[model samples]
Target: MNLALLFEDDFVSADRAVLTGRRLAHLNSVLKVSEGDLVPVGLVNGDIGTGLVVGLSDTEVVLQVELSEPPPSPLPLTLVLAMPRPKMFRRVLQTCASLGVKDIWLINAYKVEKSFWQTPWLSEENLRENKVLGLEQARDTLMPRVHIRKLFKPFVEDELPALLHNTRALVAHPGTDTPCPTHINEPATLCIGPEGGFTAYEVDKLVEAGCEAVHLGRRILRVETAVPVLVSRLFDACN
Candidate 1:
C-alpha cells in the first residue's frame, strides 16, 4: 500500500480523515505508523498528498491531510479485452490500473469461457476493491472504468467503432504479420484475447471494427503478462 486511498466517506471534515478496515490493519501492521508520523495519502479520483497521523487505535486511525498535487496523468489508452480466466482477471485488471489505463472494455470472445464472467470479481464491489488495490499500489487515485460486454458481435458491430474514434486501434493476435508498435504515446485502443487467444472469426470482427491486428513476436503471452507488456510498449507511463 504505497498510498492510503481516501474516499469521500473517509473524511470527517475538510482536513480530517479516518481509516479503518483493511487500511487500518495495514497501518497498524505493515506501516506501523503512530501519532505525529507522516503517511502517504490520496483521495480517490482526486489529488495525491500526505497525512499527519493525529490519532490511532485498534479500530481506526485518524489523520489531518493536505492534498495539493494532482494524481498521475492517466494513460491515453483504452483496453478492449477478452474475458480472461477467473484467476487471471484480477491480476490483469490491476495491471491495467497500475499502468494508468483509465478505459477498459471486457468483451466476450470465442475462446473465452462463459464461466469466466460468472466470477465474483466482476461484481461492482469486488471490481472497486481490486481497482483500489491497484491504485494504492501505483500511488495513483484516479479510478479506471470497466465496461462489460458479454455479446461479442453486438459490441464490435454496434459500439466499438465509436470507441475507436480518434484513436490508434490495434488488436494483439499471435502470428499476425504486424508486430505491436512501440512508444506511440498517443490515445490508442488495444484489444487482447483470452488464454488461447481470439479465434480467427473473432479477430476478423475486431479488425473490421477499425482495429489493426498486431502480434508480440512469436511468443504467446498470457493475458496477465501481455497486458502490462503491451501497455508499456505502447505508451510512456504517467508521463
Candidate 2:
C-alpha cells in the first residue's frame, strides 16, 4: 500500500496508465488520491518514479507516469531456507522482498512438516502474488526470484555447486562453534532451517557443501523472526 503499483498493460501511452479493479478502488477510497497528488509509483519490473494524477473515478484512475530510474539494488545475498509452515511463508516472502534480498531458495529439512509442503501457498501463482505484494510494499520493482528444492540431498550435492560459485556461504544453526559474524561485506549465501532447526546431519551436509556453520546466539528463534534478524544483521554488517 506504500506505492500505487501498476503494470505496463495498464499503460495507454507514455504519459498515461489506467488503473482499474481493486487497485483503482484502493486509490479512490482507501488512499483517497486526488488530481495532482504526485503519487509514488513504479512499473511492475521497471523503475521507481512519480505519477502525476490527472484523472480519477470509482472504477478507474489515470496517472501520467514517468519511469526512468531503476530501483535501489538488492542486497548481494542469497537466502537458502528450509521451508517453514505454510502460514509463515507469505510473511517471510514479503519480508525478504521488502528487505531487498536478491534470491531465495526453499529447501527441505528433516524437521519440516510434511503437510506444510501441501499448502496452496506453494502454488506458483500464489507465490508470485506474495512476491508482488512485497515489491509493492517496498515501492520497488525487480521481483525476487524463488526456487524450490523438495529434496535436500540433491540440492546440496548436485545443484548447489553452481549456485555457490561466487558466494561465501554460511549455515545458521544454534549449536555451532562460532557465532554469526557481525558484518560481512562480500556476497553471501545464508542457510536457515525450520522451527526446530536443522538436524546435525543436515547441517553437516551444508557445511560439507562449503557453508560455514554459524549461529545467532544461545537463544532459539522461529523461522519468521530468524530471517529478518539474520538478514538485517548481514545488511548492517555489509554497510
Candidate 3:
C-alpha cells in the first residue's frame, strides 16, 4: 500500500495527533511504519505534506505534521458522457476522477437505456466512494462534481452553449469525417455517446450547440477504451 492514502475524515492541525482504527492498522501492519519515520499525508480538499511519527502504540500512532503545499491543480476538462451500463458507469466515473477531470455531466441519449438512470452507482454516496478511490490512486484531494441531465434537447439547447463558452469542445463519433485531433492546448469539454453511439438527431443537436464531431479511427472502440485513449491523445496533442 502507498504511504499516502486517504483515510477517514481525520482533522489535521499543526499539533501532534493520533491515528487509530483502520488507518493505524494500515500503518502498523501494511505499511509497517515506525517512530521517527516520515509519512505522506494530506487533508481532503486541502494541502499535501509530511507527517513525522512521534509516538506509536498498539492502539494508535501519533504524527506531527506540517502542511506545506496546496493540492494539485485540476485538469481543465469537463466530460459529458451518455450514461453507460451500471458497472461501466462506475468505472468511467473513477477514470474521470483519476484523470483529474473537475466536472462530469452524465447525459441522456437515444441509445441509453431508461433503467440506467436508476443505477445504484448514481446515488451520491456511491458516486463519492468511486471518485475517492480514484483520488486516492492519483494522490489527489479534490473531488469532481457530477451532474445528471435526463433530457437531451433541453440540455443541449439551453445549457450547452454556456458550458462551452470559452472551452474547446469535442464530440467523439466513430465515422465522422473529421478525425479526433491528437492534441489540444486549450481547456476542453468532451462529449462521448453510449455503446451504440448517438442518434443522428442527437449529433445534430450537439453540433448545433457548438460541439464538433470528432473521430478516433476507423475501428470502433468500446466506451471504456475510447475515453482514456482520447484523453491521452488529447494530452499529447496539447503538450
The candidate that achieves the highest lDDT relative to the unseen native structure: 1
> lDDT for each of the candidates?
0.93, 0.86, 0.82
The digit string of per-residue lDDT tens for model 1 on 6-104 reads 999999999999999999999899989989999999999999999999999989999999998998899989999999999888988888888899999
TM-score of candidate 2 against the unseen true structure: 0.94
lDDT of 3 by residue, 34-136 (tens): 8999887766677777778988999878888767887667878889999998989888887777777879999999999999999999999899878876776
Candidate 2 whole-model C-alpha lDDT, 0 to 1: 0.86
Worst 10 residues of 2 by lDDT: 230-239
Report the error of model 3 at residue 36, Å: 3.6
Candidate 1 displacement at residue 236 in angstroms: 1.4
Query: What TM-scores do the predictions have?
Result: 0.98, 0.94, 0.86
lDDT of 2 by residue, 31-137 (tens): 78999888888887778888888998777888999877888688889999999999999999988888888699999999988898899999988987888788778
TM-score preference between candidates 1 and 3, better one:
1
Candidate 1 overall lDDT versus native: 0.93
**Number of backbone-clashing residue pairs for each candidate, in the order shown:** 0, 0, 3
Best by TM-score: 1
Estimate the TM-score for candidate 1.
0.98
